[model samples]
Target: MARIGITGHSNLTAASAPLVREALVTQLSLHHDRLIGVTCLARGADQIFARAVLDVGGSFEVVLPAADYRDRKVKPDNAAAFDELIGKASQVRTMPFEESNRDAYMAASEHVLSSVDAMLAVWDGRPSGGRGGTGDVVQAARERGIPVTVVWPEGAERE
Candidate 1:
């Protein structure tokens, strides 16, 4: 079994979703079976990764930044997907925070990086949005000597 973690853009546009999904699924296919995908279940990349994991007969382990992260951060349009993915997670780990914040997000990112064998980042090869963003997580994973694969197919655009 291979344990893979994901971090990526949260503002991916509708038109770019399929390209990201296809690229992600193709990369994950190399692992064959018994895949364990660890993610924060955020919108965009996280949700897409979770779906790919399920489609490939893999399990999901969700690491939430806060207890009420979904309600506080997830938009109404994406709430259903976030909720459904979280509900289907094989394991749910919430950081020790009541609300979503920078510290909580960092802690969750640390947990994902530390627990996974490798990380799949659906990044745009740009700087992070802020602390605990895709760039930060990828850097931390690299520092920890974990393999970090960047997945950004051409023509992928963010909203």
Candidate 2:
């Protein structure tokens, strides 16, 4: 199976969600039947990608930054969607941490990059805001010689 990992903006605007989802589904369709998506399943891009993967008849592997990542990082509004996606994931991996932190996030990011055959980044072409941001993961993927596909449709903005 072909494993494709996802990393992208956590604060994507609502207006861009559908656009991103459609583009992602279209891209993943090229892989046909042998597709497995790996993602951290955070809000925004992660959730969007998971939906696209499932829509394309692909399984998903969720990587949590910490054991209590959802409790610590997921907001009440996004909890339902997050929970639904988690329930649909074929596998769930949690980092060796009690709570969400920079180290845990980086570890999770590295795990995704190392486990996938390729990576899909839904970025706005900006530099990463911090260590475990999309830009950092995309750079790491490229340096490791993994193919990286960047998806940022015109007019897609962050929330």
Top candidate, metric lDDT: 2
C-alpha TM-score for every candidate: 0.97, 0.98
Q: Give the runs in model 1 whose Cα sits over 4 Å from its true position.
A: none
| Model 1, span 100-138: residue lDDT tens | 988899899999988999999999989887898888898
User: What's the true lDDT of residue 72 in model 1?
Assistant: 91
* Runs off by more than 4 Å, candidate 2: none
Q: How far is 61's C-alpha from truth in model 2 (Å)?
A: 0.5
Q: Candidate 2 lDDT, tens digit per residue, 31-111?
A: 965899999999999999999999999999999999889889999999999999999999999989998988898899999
Clashes of each: 0, 0
In model 1, what is the error at residue 101, expressed in angstroms?
Answer: 1.2
